[model samples]
Target: MERIAIAVFITGASGLIAQVVLLRELLTIFQGNELSVGIILSNWLILEAVGSYIGGKGVEKIRKRVEFFYSFSLFFSLSLVAGIYAVRLGRLLLKSLPGEGVGIGGMLLLSFLV
Candidate 1:
């Protein structure tokens, strides 16, 4: 009970922190445009909802609940690190010069992919 509550709180806090960190990285990649902020946020929300729906359905099938939870938490943390790296790498892959803004198509593609 209390342990679960604390775990939930930590998970939520870490998630929010990850979002902010990702947003900052994305803004740097996209040259800090206002539209980039909206696009990043929209994509984040949509993906989160979809992931929640899929995970919710799949979670019931797992027998080792505690192990699964811990494993998933670690995976989530690693994913955030990878996501940030991908966003930074995207700038180079897209061939955009430093401080140059990414176009809408590039932004959308990178945001969705990351």
Candidate 2:
């Protein structure tokens, strides 16, 4: 249906935008190393796949599918903003000075957490 198509398009567009914004924020946190790109992207893909799997499995239990879908979409958008905020705050939590590189282990942990 036309509504489904539009929803899908908006979801995809918003997801891509969030990914880019997160990547940029993460690159700054990790000191912009080339390896950070691979780590960030791989972690992102893995998390997305896991979330999709979990959502797919749980979706059938919902009685009000349309309302649930819209609510989940809103939650996703809000979570993206929260995620970016978290990434920015992580530097202070980790006690790292600005422009300093987080080592591989720290980068992995931070990326996975975020």
Candidate 3:
């Protein structure tokens, strides 16, 4: 569960950073302004709220039924795998030095893998 939460936060932060840069460019691309930026962020927050609520409700049922021992063991394994792969891929991509497409794909894929 901690793995899932960390994955969610890491991926969300990565995406949010990219979104910030992309959104800044829209004023030039579409002749938009700060008002458009505000709207976009508002929309993002609104969707995030809906997603968080739905996820919480969905997980509540599973949380009640699944034994903590099994569930946590599984989550621990997944976190181990995710942490190892993320480190390996991150190092590999870094050595490549600003090349290849290993960027967000690796992180995003780890979320799915776990």
TM-scores, all candidates, are: 0.93, 0.91, 0.39
lDDT of 3 at 59: 73
Q: Give candidates' CA RMSD values in order.
A: 1.1, 1.3, 11.6
Looking at model 1, which ten-residue stretch has the lowest summed lDDT?
Answer: 92-101
Off by over 4 Å in 1: none
Local accuracy of candidate 3 as per-residue lDDT tens digits, 17-106: 645554443323223545544555665576779878996787766745436545655665565556445544543543434333333444
Clashing pairs in 2: none
Clashes of each: 0, 0, 0
Error of 2 at 81 (Å): 1.4
Pick by lDDT: which candidate is best?
1
Encode model 2's per-residue lDDT on 11-98: one tens digit a residue.
9899889888988999989888789988988887899899999988998899998888799899988999899999989898788897
Error of 3 at 109 (Å): 29
